[model samples]
Target: MSAAVTPAARVERWFFPLLPNSRIAVLRAAIYLFVVVDVLVMVNDVVPKASAPAEFYTPVALARLIHLPAPQENVVLALRAALVIGALVAATNRLPRLLGWPIAVGHLIWVLYGMSYGKVDHDHLALVVALFVLPTVGRSHPHDHRADERAGWALRCIQLAVVATYTLSVWAKIRYGGWDWPSGATLMWAVERRGTFLGEHLVHVPELLVLAQWVTVAAELAAPLVLVLRGRALGLAVGFYLSFHLITYAAISIHFLPLVVCWLAFAPLEKIGQRLETRPVSLRRGHLARRAAAGQAVAVVGHEAVQPVPDPAERRDA
Candidate 1:
């Protein structure tokens, strides 16, 4: 019998699974869409805050490191304009290399400038990586749905970033909240500060809050398993993760849409794209058999192709 696959081999496959460029392109489009939406709609409050008194400008680590100036009204307006316009241009994916890097840098600056007031969100970790990686990868084509290692590499980076976002969250709890975080003190504090309707009621159950704190740690730590999961297993993991975010939103006022979109890294988006791109049943019946025959011819050359369902007549002939 052949030797069993090693853990290293499994990890290699997990990070480097074959995926179509179209899927990567689709993911890029989705990420860009969310970035635009966040700047335009969701985080509109940040724009106004940029005009806050220079005394209110409290820079984060990155901003301090980069020595970003205090947000003057005109400066903030210019940065905001650049970020929004750059995001719009990048979303179109025309001249990605030209627009992508500037957009990525501008976005980081925009987020940092806004975050300078006080709070800094970690949700955009994967988004930052996604924007940078998109410019590096070759443009994905529609009809050319083939497995690409380069495309997979870019996606794998985002996947690792997403996983790190969760797994590393535990470290933050330990560092700041300390080992007693499971005692529900942090939850109590957070709820007291900004609890929503669900959080308000749940605050009464300290024991349940304690249980939830531990559960969050467990779930976040288990996030890396999404890489190893396949097919239905992956779908289940996706649902669980999505539900986790939804529950957080329902209970607390925190939103993680940036992180949520990054979970597309683990999704079978290529298959979804294939399904959506599928021709109509009647049209497919007429043309698919011919392509199937041609595919067989190409397969003899050891070229792989995505096969559609065979027509009833074609199936009967076979």
Candidate 2:
């Protein structure tokens, strides 16, 4: 007579087979790329003009929000540097639990300081929400391969916020620009008025302009539903959103880091991590051989040797 395999054993066999892969490595690389690009763009835009007359900060706005006096230019610059360091740490998944929240908060403060210069835009709001919520989520360490439950929740929250941004924008367009938003020339005029890189060129191609306007409306209107779909569907939706942002960047010169970072939420980061762990040299050969020998020795006693389960989740977070 034989006993059935335990549920845990069955689960280990089905879901966590031992195999070498590079999914996590790829995802980590992607994250690093995004962070590096963001940092470069920020430096190019902010550093050269930091001391210019137009780059001044206003104290009244800070007092209105938190009832505290605004710091001087030197203090703000120091905080901005700290914020960049924190963002880099978070992107690398180094000391995530300890550094994530402070980095996020510091980013918010830095943005607020920038906004105090009599200039604010809708694109900046997404970053604020992302920074505010990132600290409450997962801790990425070198040894833990499994997704932290809190981190997963944090990603989900970020997704919801992204969806809301699109939904509200669509609503505003309809309310303020009217139902003719889909077919009307309002979006075209708005882009033209902005006079950004692609805006003038886009207006020159009437057919392309019409297509862009309609697609923007369609994408924003469907954003909520698009976010609800998981896995590959979500991936596609995120790609679409990325296209939207890229187009905006080209056309309107908008600087929205959160919209770009949101793409990470759609990526299969956990699966990527699992693949990376398995691709390295296997130290299990000797152990497996010894175990097999022991099993053969036990066979004489009328019992089979049970194989050990592969637990990828046990690996540390990268």
Candidate 3:
């Protein structure tokens, strides 16, 4: 009595599974909050770079295509303020498409302006993709756990972008450093330049660093496996990546926090909102139960006092 699924249907289902809208809501808030912090901390140089000479403003490819101008003091300041305000408003989930679209575009331009000088970071790829895709989901609420294809698609895009970020790193490494990248002194070189106290001590064990390099390359190459992994296997894979990032940061000061934030796409984030909404109700019920127990000696029935029926458990305890 069931309909058969076709190959195209299978592909569509893979790309767009039905996930809770609450996950989208949670992701939106987290991503927006990160944007606020990022503008202030990680990429704060946008306004400052406005003062840098026009000659140093070598626009990136996207900027050139969009005809984005060189950063000006007034323009950059306004863009920064707008970005912060837009992100704050969007986090509130009001007029999502209206605010989110501009925020995405503004963030792109903001990062483009920053990177134009030199040094384009790969970490923002997933985050930028998330910003664009999330808006397509329109409105989602933390308490709304309804399964939505929109939310699933958005999450899937972010997950793919995250996997691509890891997978592409391998490609880039192979392209630039050849097949022997894992056996090379790349990790050692990075440690020498920006290594922390831990990394400094780690340099003494050269073979361990080389082994770590091999593990990292192998892990990144296998990053796509996370998509097909289910249940505990999926959780373990995500944990492994998070642990790798943590260890990387401890060894060197570099932390791809933007990319790390996107990892929530893999989490059952709807539980957080659901628990928060239900906790107060559960507490109120408990409070009433305690009060009832305190006055269990008597009960009022039809405005007449009567002996209360004791619970079997209480009688057993007595």
Candidate 4:
């Protein structure tokens, strides 16, 4: 007889779903790769910002609490070197705990160091949270698709962060911009300031920008629905958000690549890894089978050289 599941147990199950460790493995590699790219290309200003005047340095709250010093050129360079090298090594899935924890901590400080200069980008929320949680998954096999609660927990943390990015954006909009934010000329102002040619043209269509602002708010407000959506619905929801990011970038030249990368938490990326790992093995098997069919002599260890076995009909005739 089976015991009844308590409400707490059910909540636990939902929170720590038994997803495959392979998914974590794939997600880890992708995230670490993105970190290397991010430091090099997207947020490549840390070292340069170190060259800025000392008077301009204003540490964020966490930096202030920890008494972290303002970025120095030497320190920033060393941090960048360590972060890039560590991210590359960690992406290979070797010594996960040893490499991953430092990368996570180093990246947090790196972001703080960069944002200390005045401008702070919120797109990093999901990515930073992802780096911290990914280390908790430890080592996961690229070929092992077996369900693991630990991997699920780590992925759930990332997914939650992703959701929070959107939901919190709405809160900030309302809190800072007020209830009239959606109806206001916020999008129009952005278009007028930094928008691409497409965005500039789109703004001319009367009330279009206002409509877009409202739609953006409504979509973000419905962001929580992504957590509860399943199967095709979930895929569509993720797809929709991805499409939204692409469109946003196309129109405004602004992108959320960091947060976009973290969206892979909801994907079955384990399947991609599994398929890639098995492809070579499958090809080798096909090669051996083809050689055997041609009656080619094959050497067997601890046995004599042998020809392919005869078909059942051929054996009967003999």
lDDT of each: 0.78, 0.58, 0.91, 0.89
**lDDT, candidate 3, 28-146, per-residue tens:** 99999899988888889988899989989999898899998889999989999999999998888887899999999999888898789998888898999999999999999999999
Judged by whole-model lDDT over C-alpha atoms, candidate 1 comes out at 0.78
lDDT per residue, candidate 4, 1-318, as tens digits?
Answer: 999999999999989999999999889999999999889888899888889998889998988999988789998899899999999999988878999999999999899987888888889999999999888888887888899999999999999999999999999999999978998888878888889988989888849888888989999989889999999999999999999889788778889999999999999999997799879977766666666677665555333334575667777999
User: Tens-digit lDDT track for model 2 on 198-278?
Assistant: 688777876777677788888888987865586788777788788778778788776466566655655665665555565
Error of 2 at 31 (Å): 6.8
Ten contiguous residues with the weakest lDDT in model 1: 297-306
Ranking by lDDT: 3, 4, 1, 2
Residues 141-172, candidate 1, lDDT per residue (tens digit)? Answer: 54458888778888999988998899888888
Clashes of 3: 0
lDDT of 2: 0.58
Model 2: residue 193 alpha-carbon error in angstroms: 5.0
Native-to-model Cα distance after best TM-score fit, residue 192 in candidate 1, in Å: 3.4
Cα-based TM-score, every candidate: 0.80, 0.64, 0.91, 0.91
